[model samples]
Target: MTRPRIVIGNWKMNPLTPAAATTLATAVAREAGRVVRVGVAPPALFIPVVAEVLRETRVGIYAQDVSAEEKGAFTGQIAATMLTSYVNGTLVGHSEARRYLGDDDERVAKKLIQVLRAGLEAVLCIGEREDEFDAGATEDVLAAQLGAPLHALSESDRDGRMTERFVIAYEPVWAIGTGRPATGEHATAATKTIRRVLEEDGGIDGDAIPILYGGSVTASGAIEFAKAEGIDGALVGGASLKAEEFAGIVRAFA
Candidate 1:
């Protein structure tokens, strides 16, 4: 069966102290049973510590990113296996990684495979740039991004085993941390398209894949977006930094 909706907080680069982690954990524990599933992706330095805090709570801890390689001399890279050992989960193909760190489709595909091998769920992100959106290439871009990696999955990888342990986040690159979000209608349309692509290309059922919206998501915006046609949940940014605000977004899904 398909998993329930998920609300994920991407605590990107903020909260530099243990005190901040404690506050967020307390808030998540307070609202534990309210939502279907809630997760927080803290900086790598805090993954293990946060994992411990949320262990008794319903909230899951996720790594911001993971390397496709199992192990290497590659300095400064955290492998998926290491993430599974440290964090409760991992996010792959975030836009920032694609834009700044140069993670391409092939890299993302490899990371997804590694995440699966490591026995940790992976969150795959896909979105279009501002120029692509203006050029009406939103659907095309999403299809290409999602299709490439999925199409690369081997027959052994499709044995119904590896396919079920992942989620997809549709984070419009134009809207990320920019204070502007894609309209509810636009978000819905994009998610629907993503679902269709999964079904058509990956042989994944539309109902089985959890498609999330990410990009300037807030507590106030959660209800409207959650009410959207195909949005399974959200990958929140700035709003997620605050415990109260992030908890509010989780409650919106409830």
Candidate 2:
């Protein structure tokens, strides 16, 4: 099966105010019909407002992150179920989540389980650090991140009920927000690694998974990555803030 091409804009606490977020969300939602799968992850505070607006639009709403715990005394932690009604999915293991928030692969694994259990999609992020990439530890790191975590999910696959709802975004840590040059080639390699691990190690249908390339993705980058073999889409960062820019990227798939 040919996986659907997607573009996910992760609006990580930007535009300064709720009103500004509504404006951007509206802009994106207006043009979201251009792509088969397009989503935006706004700050949690604006989720309700944007969700209400985008509910009728073709665009999908995604949470930037979610708590691994189903429920607890963990103050300030948002559970997976909390976002189900609002968003089509949630993003986990983002570089920022792992860096500033200290979300390791184990934590990401738990978060994915929770997202899946709640019947929501998980846009799981996995990547290699600058040094790790230089040392050719990319595949190893991806295997550890994608392999051991979903081992238990293979049982669901055997039941023939688990459609490919999950997505993988491979972001090289060094390239994100640094304006580093990376797109087609880098994403091709990363997607191959991700697919191999999912099919060979995880015993899941790798070909059915939609793997995207993130880290400094621009409109032009989206055009390139979309054409590259094995690259299904893009997980845009700063470029996603602008409606015209993100729309151009969304149209790249078409």
| TM-scores for every candidate against the unseen true structure | 0.94, 0.95
| Tens-place lDDT digits, model 1, residues 62-176 | 8989987889898899998777676767899999999999999999999888887788888999999999998999999999999988898876766676556779999989987
Model 2 scores a TM of 0.95
RMSD of 1: 1.6
Per-residue lDDT of 1-254 in model 2, one digit per residue for the tens? 87898899999978678889889988997788654689999988889988987878889999999998999899999999998888899998998999999998778878888888888888999998888978989889999988756775647643443445689998889787665667687678888889989888777788888888887888877788878899888889889999999988888876
Best-matching candidate per lDDT: 2
CA lDDT, every prediction? 0.84, 0.85
- Using TM-score as the measure, which candidate wins? 2
Task: Tell me how far the alpha carbon of residue 189 in candidate 2 is from the true structure, in angstroms, after superposition.
Answer: 1.5
Off by over 4 Å in 1: 1-3
